[model samples]
Target: MAAVSKYLTAKNSAAAGGILLVLYFLKQRRRSAALNRKKGSANDLNSEKDGKKERAAVDKLFFVRISRIIGIMVPRLLCKETWYLFLIAVMLVTRTYCDVWMIQNGTMIESAIIGRSTKGFKKYLFNFITAMPVIALVNNFLKLGLNELKLCFRVRLTKHLYDEYLNLKKIITGHYVDHLHNFIFFRFSMGMVDSIIAKYFATVVGYLVVSRPFLDLSHPRHLSSSHAELLEDYYQSGRMLLRMSQALGRIVLAGREMTRLSGFTARITELMRVLKELNSGKYERTMVSHSEKDVSEKLTLVPGSGRIINVDHIIKFDHTPLATPNGDVLIRDMCFEVKSGTNVLVCGPNGCGKSSLFRVLGELWPLFGGSLTKPERGKLFYVPQRPYMTLGSLRDQVIYPDTHEDQKKKGISDQVLKEYLDNVQLGHILEREGSWDVVQDWMDVLSGGEKQRMAMARLFYHKPQFAILDECTSAVSVDVEDYIYSHCRKVGITLFTVSHRKSLWKHHEFYLHMDGRGNYEFKPITTETVEFGS
Candidate 1:
């Protein structure tokens, strides 16, 4: 119990220190800003205004922070399995009473020794020995209950954060789990500290009541006995000093821990505020066109289409007067359309809007002035330069975005999945890892080429209407790349691929070349175009 108390105290002190540091930093920044404003510079004033708004937002969230902390604690405590909480309360109450009784007995033993009374000493000593076993048993059980409570709190808090605020990727690590546990544990420790202080204070008060006669500053008019007086004086002085020292220590410790608690509340409040903003979509990027003229010259939205993708009178103008999400205009007055079951190869130099054009088509980047017609969301899929592999087995990797139920509904057999893997020449993975159920840290395990090939395998599984291969095959050899493209074509999946490889031109029917200097040319891939190599 003493070891546990010490550990909690250290953690509380550290939390208080963290809060202090954050507040200090914030104070320093405000002071610096004030000094700069006093210099009477317009630029300084403008910068100050921006910074002050952010600071004010943070300041205003203190109440919200407290609310968030309460939110983390209350629901879990009041939850269905609140029996754990009841058990903890009972344990704490038992532990507190036991502590007080032991302290009282200890004080009596001290007085007995000082008085040199053999009989009194033996009586207190027998009481102490008898209580020791029960106290030990209670302490052990209390510790066990406290640990279980911490685990319960951790699990609930983790669910809240993961399900509501943050995604799985950010909070998957053991470090994050420990962070959640510490947050709840600190509050529990504060209650323990309070109980300890109250017990000690009550003990000291009881001693003062009994020793009031000797502690009176005034000299006694009628003495009891000279020897009694000496003993009383000695006891009074020592007890007063010890109580004062203990009180001072408790006050300092409590104040420090409370400060840390405040700090923790501040940090958590800020996080909740951010999460709220994210949930409200307040931080989502605003899509603005390069030119006001371009915004006004909106192309008519094509009524509807069964085509895989369409680009109608798409004019990507220069971003001279204003900045766009895509830095500068690389393709000017670009216009093209890919009907159903047709592939277009987008070719451009570095910094040209090859990928940017695809982003616009995919509705990721803002369309400057054009009618971009595309199929529904699930109908289109993009294969980036780096494919993301989520934490799951190889089966999950193949039929991604599709749950096992969905796969079962579609009647997708393991044999079919293996064949898809075979298409990407990754059939060896099956034999090496034993089966499709084997899970691996694929990001570290797979080579760049292998990862891209795996991505291709995934594409084969989904087989969307159009797949934007954005340099997805750069690391892939020419033969494998050819095979992947051919396979997609055979699957009736129209492709809008961005690549610098000259070998890629033969796979598509037409070419859309971007000149980086706001000019574009589009035409069928001619026999003469086959000679050029990037």
Candidate 2:
């Protein structure tokens, strides 16, 4: 009777532990789900209509996205990742078997003590001691395999993303910016949820198992062989039940991990889809205007488009409408022509299509009306208001967009580059920064005026037939700017200058003026024109 009562007590304790574990896991899952819904609601409210549509698509095809991502990460059946996964599965099975053996051996140890059999106790204890190393080895090996698998997934996925993103055939600047924003936001939001759930589970599990009570052996009750055997069976069965509950809890946690993976899969799949569309020359953007008519039209490509022709030695735009990427038409009809050595000055109000015209000429924005004729790609160059500093040595600052080999192919040595720098009065930077090989964060290291001068040097190094100077020398002194202009004319390079400075009027042969109302005049630059314009 005592043995039966003790067996019942042990059985009840194990059942209670299992129940508590399950209840805790359930509570955590509910809490996580509630938090997710709250966050998702806030995101939906702040997101744009396009974002909402994308989210809907992602949710609707969650499983399909997961499969696509899995295909990318593990491309082949005979890959190393597959072998790692197989080994991990084997280790898991081995660990489960070891756990079962340890549980049974523990119950036997307890029985031996209860029956006062020293030989049985010593034998079972030896078995437990012998199995501990094997269990530890299996556990560690499983962890190593999992880490390796994760690394392989990351490497493969990153490589695939790079291939799509950096493909030269269909690169879109605005699309990349949008995709980056989505990637960051989704990862952060989903990663937070996973982190919170994992930490909560770990804390609860630690506290629950911190002071587990062993079998009550203070008062041993001897029993018949049958009762002892039956008691051992009961104890082992209870322990196995507790282990099963723990395993189920782990499975639930893994499901949470899968939820996070689904988020990642959605983001990656969306990126791939967008890239494919861009490669095919199809693009979509939210219309800035909220007109019902505009929404109804819903043009996939930029509306009212035109044609582009590549020619040599001249650039002409015949009735091209300057439009922004957001479908805001800046100018209805723009017509201008410039040949080699013809310098033109552009002046206008703040939003009056001064830069927009240049963007069309450069093919940065789509030509959205009449025909455009420009010199082949290498004959034209652009210098923006703010210059971009490449990541390389001082020599790279001058010979930008060209490698040392390219410079060598042109038979222009570093000494020639130095002369180009001197034309812009930046020759002393080599001695100041120690040598041509010295590299630093040039953007932060150089002042605004120095950066502008370096950009001019880069222009001189390239020496294209036509250069669009969009207020690029805003930070330079009038004297240095004049010298730069004289050097450009000396080199026979045509200029389309975008500036409102009175000092820049003398260098250009013609002036193109734009009013904010889309009216424009292209006329010769004279004393009357400059004074009247001022």
Candidate 3:
């Protein structure tokens, strides 16, 4: 009858498990269907497809990314603070030993109780009591130390990445700025805050609630006839419960650590990818002058490539075709150049290659199928329609890409910075913001025209030989625009400006007009050639 009852119980358990499996399968199917619906929806299908492609790419590079991340961390671990890591290792070993010792002493106590050896029971109990507090103290101390070490490591990693970001000499695009936030999030996760909290918090709670109950279950009973059996059964039950709780705690902690680690890895890998892009010279644009020698040499534009071709009287483009980064040709076999001191006005309808032409000149875009000449990087400057407001004092904005020390060496002073601001009619900002040294969020505090005027102030401060002002004065009044151009001309800053304003032609000597259909015209802008569509 007992065997029959056991078989019935086993069958019931099996049936329950089968029902659970079916439910789990249905749940998973529903989840997959929901994901498919999101992926197939009209509004999000294209974005979902792109996300899938990105995911696939990430999967392909996951192992390489992991290796790179490890490569970054391992060196720090083995640095001068290597002793700290060894101490952490020793602490972990001590923790494991304490756990094993506790289990062994626990079994000994149970045996002593069952054998009715009062002396043995007392000795084992005293040993357990002595070791428990010491072990707990050591464990907590080690955890605190570990967290501090992790924090130090995170700081070092963040500083290294910041140095890399600063070393990149390119314009800070909006896309790069967005990724900068993601990179900071990655840095914060590097501390493994979740794992630390889980370990300490769960351990304390497990000891308070779990250990107290186990102790209650294992408490000594009155000495009686059934004392040995009763004590033995209770001891065994308490040991099983304690071990089960510890195992479950470890599993939960491991799951949380793994989840945080996965997130940290993804964010770090993406940040590294962006850093690589920022450091690369030719990402979207093809350099017509890139040769084995030039690649091996410095990253500057080659003299023949597009910086200085004075012998030809103008920087020539030999059958050059301009294309978008995606390889769609915008202007084919186009050729033009402005010599030193010759100001050119780039006029075209919206969506034409006027701005793109400046991009090519700025070396921010690739010049395809043509060799062009441009001055060395520092000799040229670009002021976009929406100027970049760097994070610093008003002086920093004007003399950006140049440190205060560099400017000092170049004989620039606070007085000079203030003068440049006055040149752009922004000298009032000095008083409004307190002084040139008073730092503020200039982008937010300054209006649109004020920002452009600040950019012009920067231009006047740098005094580059050639400046590409792409509708930079669109926000300023006509009078202000005239003043800004007059300042540039007075400072001998040759202009390659893209503007629809007819009032700007008087400041330029030549015009390069595009029709947005791979057609362009380049000629002297004289009295008869100043009208639109001319």
Candidate 4:
């Protein structure tokens, strides 16, 4: 949890830091903009205004920076004991220098046995050098291996960042998922690993360079107790001291930077809490009432078997409920029934409450005046007029709601999937790399008409009985639309369609209509002797 706190705090610091960076960049841009405007006009007045804004932006940036340090980086330092060991290993392995130290030293013979004279030691030293590097490498490499143990330390911040990334990729909806994934997966993990490896390797090289001076000698025969050698030793010792000082300074700075990051994390968390208040306070609510008073509440009584999804009594746009001002709900009395194997068409006109009705039914919005009954959350599939596609293999697109193993269990093979794609005219596109679950800027690749067809392919793959398609096939050609619908019909799928293409109306046997007066009348357009093109 401390690691999570650390991660959050770090993220917070980054966010705060970003705010600073943005403000600085904006200030610079504005200054330039003002200068440009001033260059032709009166400079004094505009300059004063630009100066004021720049100063304000600078002040905010400074405060945000300070907040990042306190909120993010400080907490990391507080809990860094867990991670210090690995970093220390990185330091130790990087600084090892026995080989470099031995490179220039006096006669190889003396080194083999400490008391032997410098020239006599040469033979043994030659033998030792060949075998010693192996032991030295192993010993030093083992110390570096200690780096693996560091992963065991588990920084709270790193884990939290990962969790946030995971939850985002797995559960959260809307735009931020892709953006956050890019940052956490690429920037934090791979980027940090690269930077760290480079610095440590540089330190290792430095050790090799620094150790070279120790081997330089004056008059090799008189290895000890000689004035010339002593002076030379003194010069080399001074150089070593200077190099060590420089290395020490660098270590201090690295430590300080880590501290800064830690502190920045703390300040970031402090500020971030304001943003994360929504997430950290997740409270699972138990449905309180077994029975609902109004149709709205009644909708809740069914206990949706597919997903324990939340349904609200009011749908608000900005703070106002999207309803008729007369307390006549744009969606007055409504019950949403989505059973598996049902296809629902959500239809209405330019503000006749069709999209609003689907929005309410799909659980995206609240029923302004009714309660909703739903199955398990995430079970019901909603295909909008313009469906969203991700960048992935073509396989991913066809197998969306990817969690449901039943499709595979039912022996829905590649052949079956391809047949479905061909029905929707997407079979040709499948051969394109990554077309299976292609997450391209597909919004661009496929024309508006093709996108709707692709949505149908997604719908067919999931085969969720209960689907609310709100003009989902709007842009498709009438024939393609007929093919998709006819396929659904052959599959005996229950459907609720909302479309103005009167050609599509006969596809649904049951219909619910909402009047502009904010009251919905659910009547049986239902005919049991179901006939298509009726």
Candidate 5:
């Protein structure tokens, strides 16, 4: 009887120890949870402060910038991008529903296994397997839709930028001024803000509340199920909460991504602003003045006082002030004129407004103050020392700035093009390069002399009224240059030759000489008047 009583006491002691251990563990868990909550609150406060600072640094007109970018991405409401975005939304909703269903299905399966119900387990397992394929399809399609949407956005933005960049007329018209103004005045209504908030509110609240109910699973009577069933429910609830947290984490990550996107948006918008300013013929230059009094003229726009008149068969410049783009006066006042069939040789010392004169004539540089007259566009062609070689076939070299279709429209055949090449002594290239359709990197492939001759061939093909040969034959031999000059005379193409070569004086009727100073002289090129060295 004493041995039996001792065994009972030992058993009671073990039971008491087990109870104390359980109570200690429960207290420790509560303490850990409290510490975690405190850390989380501190982190939340820090994150909120950081987010506000980042937002302030991003842009004051952040929404306007976003709206403009969105406008560029989706010019039309019923576009392909819109369709893809809709599909992505649908997929996200479907995925969320599938997640919920999966959680419930898993709970059923777990309950079946705990109860040792073989039929129920098999039924739930089959359901899980069947649903997997559908889930996989949804996931892949979602990825595809997202990628396509990205591509569409990229294409749209690129095309928009190219349009603004490439269209010279649009840039010159100052259209971007209005666009910038519109962006500044862009209104972000309260209703729209409310709508955006409303869209995400449900998702955020749902995620936050998802784990709340599962946390208090101490009472099995709250659920109309057995203890095993309650355990399965609790397990599934935990898994669902984990998934919800992951989704919430992605949302938070997206906020960081948006912060990065704001940087890119700011850069793009700044670039657009600069381009618009340039398009409107406005430029900013930091002028370093020689004297302190001239500091007020640090930046100035070119005065729009120049007029260009397009008249056939005559070129003239009246009181034109030749200036560089930096607002430096190259020539204060200049007057010149040449009628049809009058070939003038332009000669000047370095930086003496020689090229600047032609730049004004070509409308490339803004005319500061002048009344200039020139032949209509396409009637005047300038061939530089280094001619441009386009990317295309051998035939394209001769008829540059004109396509094969344009050549055909002008009733010029490959045979005629060959004749032009032959005139420039480049006809052999056809045989060497295979055929007219053979394409190569012409700039790298052709020699410098060949490129000049090719430009001459292009000149012959177009047969302009006046051609500015700016040392275009420097690379070619004297004989080839003579042939090219004779051919120009034969074709009745007047030439404004800029050269120091004495042999070219015979081909020109007039000489325009500019000293390194602002002074210049325009005179008839005669035997007695022609100065050999000077």
Candidate 6:
């Protein structure tokens, strides 16, 4: 009668498991369908970018998709490491099981070790040896899989962080403005935030480790009644420690989040201050005091790079009491000329405002105490020190600031594109589909030299009449640097470059030097000769 009841129970358990298997398969199929649909829709980006606003929208959507994957994968992966520490626990369980069974007769050593002498000891040793390989193999396999999975997850997470940094870097590089202070603050604050979260995660894992032993009991009253009661209390203390750890981790996370929030709040306040001064017209009276001169009518033209640069004076701000005597002339005057066939090299030591002058010319930042003429806008393109890479394809980065029609009109052929990459040496990366769109794990794919070379490739594609190469080739090797300068010189791009290299000096026909005391000198390169000291 009992055997019949046991057979029925076994059949019921098997049927329940079969139902679960069917449901799991159905769920997996649904997920695959959703992913395929998204991937299919993602393929038509080029056709959809018909308008300016639509293109911008598509660009944003492209970034959001990459970011969404990163966001989902990160927290899940970080939490998964705690499972590794759990493997140690399974060992203790096996040991406890052996200890319990051995105690069923007398104390383990009394009968098993002493009564039968060598025979009993051999049996025990053989048992351990027989089970040892199985235990070690299981543990080793589990650890190997976990390590490989962790490594893969870690690589993916690192890639995501780089993606986030690159995206934010683009916005930070607006107008080529110097935002060194802002960058420091941003990285420092975010770093603290990341640290806090990771520490909290570790704390949570520690708590689980301390408490899991208490919760894993098969029977509560196995020992002598008093002994069992004492053991329960002893293990229950582990749970209390876990609860305390959880509380501490939560508190730390909350505090760290508040600190980051404050940093953002301070940025808003600074922007508001700038706005209020502008709205209040704080500089209007000062700007008008210069005899009410017509800055526009004082236009001058030095035709170079297919455009005219009209400005009376360029200066370096002294930022000292003597330079600003009436608290008026904060900067000194500089004059220069440019002809159609010359490259203008702006050279100075670090922080001498070489980059700032480019921004003034680019019309990104306002020029102090001077009037600049309006040139045809599309003829100019500014390349900064660090090339800004976005979350898109190589095609997108290459054709920036130009429309699809413009690209076609400019005659960008496959051969041209491939040749340009080959010149800069980034051809292999672009060969892979979605290589540019592929989220990068590290900027190391291109070395400093490679990045600079790649930037030059973009320069080749754009073929802008005027190119501002502002330390844009610093990371490039000296050989590649000379090659780029040689090419630009040959092409007659009318370059305005800032470099510390003497090798590069020969390529330019004009020069400018700024001393930080608000003093500057501008000269035609034809009249100057610089010799290294003997």
The stretch of ten residues in a row with the least summed lDDT in candidate 4 is 298-307
**TM-scores for candidates 1 onward, in order:** 0.55, 0.63, 0.57, 0.42, 0.56, 0.42
Full-model lDDT, candidate 5 = 0.75
Task: Encode model 5's per-residue lDDT on 1-534: one tens digit a residue.
Answer: 333333333255336434644554456447546766766666668975654322212345777887888998998989999999999999999988988898899889988988899999999999999999999999998999999999999999888777665432211347888887665664344234333433354244434344343344543434567678567856775686466545544543454366568877877777677556655756544333222345464433353357788998889889876666556665666788998788999998777778887766776666666678888767999999999999898888889999999999999988898898899898889878878999999999999999999999999999988889998988888888899998998997989988888778888889888885657888998879755532
- Could you give candidate 2's per-residue lDDT for residues 1-534 as a string of tens digits? 334334445456547556765775677668666766876876788677435533322244888787888999989999999999999999999988888788989999988987789999999999888988888999999999999999999999899877765442312999999999999997797567545544554444433332122232433332333667656755775676556545645654576566677677777888888666644556655334232335464323343247878887788889876667666656666788888878999888888888878766766556555788888667889998899999999988888989888989999988888898888888888768877878899999899999989998999888898999988989999999999999999998899998868888889998888887758888887667743333
TM-score, candidate 5, is 0.56
Number of backbone-clashing residue pairs for each candidate, in the order shown: 1, 0, 7, 74, 0, 0
lDDT per model, in order? 0.65, 0.75, 0.68, 0.52, 0.75, 0.53
Stretch of 10 with least lDDT, candidate 1: 299-308
- Estimate the TM-score for candidate 1: 0.55
Clashing pairs in 1: 16-260
Cα lDDT of model 3 by residue, 313-391, tens digit: 2455666666554444567567776776788888777777776776666556554445766666677889988988889
Q: Rank the candidates by lDDT, best first.
A: 2, 5, 3, 1, 6, 4
- Structure candidate 3, residue pairs in collision: 285-366, 306-372, 306-373, 306-374, 307-373, 307-374, 307-375
Quote the positional error of residue 426 for candidate 4 in Å: 1.8
User: Which residue window of length 10 is worst by lDDT in model 5?
Assistant: 1-10
- In candidate 4, position 31 carries an lDDT of 66
Give the winner by lDDT: 2
Better candidate by TM-score, 1 or 6: 1
* TM-score attained by model 2: 0.63
Where model 2 places Cα greater than 4 Å from the true spot, the runs are 1-60, 66-213, 218-275, 278-305, 531-534
- Candidate 6 lDDT over residue span 439-475, tens digit each: 4532455566666677788888877667778878777
